[model samples]
Target: MVSAQPHRVGAELWGQLEPNAGLIILEGSSRKYPYIDAEALVWGGAGATQLGSSDNDATFEALVMTIKVRDPRGVSDTRLGRFMLSTGAVRAMHIDGGHLMLRARSKTHFEVFGGVPVDGNIEGRKYDWMVGGRVSQGLGNKGMIGASYYNRFNAGQRSAAEAGGAAALRGASWVDPSAKISWELVNPGLAEVLGTISAQTASRVIRGELYVTKRSPTRMLQSTSLFTVLGDPGTLAAGGNLRWRAAPRLDLWVNGALQDAQDDFGWSGYLRGVLRLDDDGKGSILGELRRQQVATSSWTGLRLASVIPLYEDHDTTVGLMPEFEIIFPDHPEPNQGNVWPWGRLALRWQPTKSWAVAAAVEASANQIERYDVRALARVSYQGQWPKK
Candidate 1:
């Protein structure tokens, strides 16, 4: 006979010592959905970074992938991995909780924009996924926050590794997207000392879903020397928007942001108006302009773009757009040197509502200078799901 105590927490079973009898099996919920999403882009053209030439065409290709799944309540949700680049290289994979989560940065391409302080991804491109809870009860809205990381398991190009060695990797280069990472910080000297804090506001009216957010990165450092002075980028933004239903599928929105300098005390203001031509669906003509005003420089340029919809009615879609990007980095100086002109054509496809694949081809030339073309493709994905 085996003896056991119902109050005890541990016990042996069968041939082993019998233990506690008070143990109870707990039932947990299961996930409701398993979702997979992917995005990819291939580009070919010319640029300063490709083919080792600054005056000729550069050709390149890229891709992106994002995957997500739902889990039960109380337990951690599955992670959503994202990779965005001119190539289909994995860059970031993160999970969401609330204020707590993990983010692992890849080593291939590093990007630094504002003066925001950041630590290098010590865990490299990969790390454990972590996230806090959602933001709903308080704001009457829904969103998630999480983190993730990834690591390199091997070194050769994906195709090359399949063929087995350095030579194969080299041979695959023509088709394989170049991999890289970017990290940078902006410091605006002298500008921070003389600037004033900004206060801006905006409103928009339309139909559909309206995602209005204040204080976004674009509203901050678009054209400032802040990356040169303050070390921390300045961006203050506020806006309200709505999607309307009418002819040309019109959408009216107004936005403004305060762009402060880095070191000295100076501030630039930005305001934008957007009009969507074919509001009945997803095609339209878009225009944008940013007013650049620093202590010594002040100028503005406008852009016109034609938007085409792809894969309508699906959680994923595609679009093709072409636009002109003109920047007068320095103002007043008689608009001197090159009145540079450039045009870009882009193809963007999304496999999931939260992910997109983008490819861009650009060509530029100063009437008298040599012309060049550049190409790049990227995969970008983002998602926010309410915990269940």
Candidate 2:
């Protein structure tokens, strides 16, 4: 598990277990401000079987519990938490009984869920908990599908105007599934194509995604396409990245697309690469080259990076990393001679499995470069949950 703060919730990895089961719970600050926050996760069922012969087996169940609240630093805040369990390979269920607050990037803002706060300011806070179910299946070696539904809630019995908006906490939002097929030829040739399409009536939105990749003796590349139709007047559309490694530690790539909903057709791509010297054991030097084309402009960039790890005792280790980058405008404009340089320093200490912590800081700059400071500290207690 990794988190920004001691009390902050984050992600969890169960390692590479052929058939293992466990539960994980996370809580963290989304907005990291006065109040508004969010939490999200991927989980499995509890006390599930590994497809032996019994449906009551308890060895293969995986569960996830996540809850986020407002005013994490204050008293009397709202909370949201849910537990999902895996009953079998093709069968699983979840119970949603916690409060929730959801927010998106820059578009659709503010979704109040599960037990609204009494502050009366709908901008933040949530009300009511919704329950739902989800089912998923894997197809052959390149396809998967999933579908789910849940119910919504409210503060209390109220008139239509005071009842807030419609809660989409229940019912099947949409069925989502995707497939990818690949073919490999000898050691020098390979090709793959993938696609996905989803439409939801509750939100009145339709989405489509496509991806393709091809590799040959001397070069390899991949690209993606995305299109979204919102019930509203606007639509969202874009594409993915394309990268090619021309030589050892050398790469070139470009990415961009149109987001009609935002009235923007922005795209930018670059050429970047890294090189390592004396890679056997001592140290190494790295370099990069890049060029980018946006909706209305073109630019070029470069990067230089290096790292070294020093060892003394068998129990302790230290490393240092530094990098620098510069960008030049295609058609020399005002403040066009822009350059950015960034660097990081890290220290690690691991006395035992029960204790370990790493500290790091980074700084960078642009044309009007400003040195920003950041730090991280971690502490934990480990006894091997399964004691393997």
How do the predictions measure up, each by TM-score?
A: 0.38, 0.41
Put down candidate 1 lDDT per residue, 34-142, tens digits, no spaces: 2222233223334434223244544342222223333222222232223321111122222221121122232112211111101112333122222112111111122
How does model 1 fare in lDDT?
0.35
- lDDT by residue (10-37, candidate 2, tens digit) is 4333211222233333335443444544
Candidate 1 residue spans exceeding 4 A from truth: 1-70, 78-248, 262-279, 295-297, 308-320, 331-336, 346-361, 366-370, 375-388
Which candidate number would show the highest lDDT if scored against the true structure? 2
lDDT of 2 at 294: 49
Candidates' lDDT values, in order?
0.35, 0.39
Candidate 2 weakest ten by summed lDDT: 159-168
Q: Looking at candidate 2, what is the lDDT of residue 21? A: 35
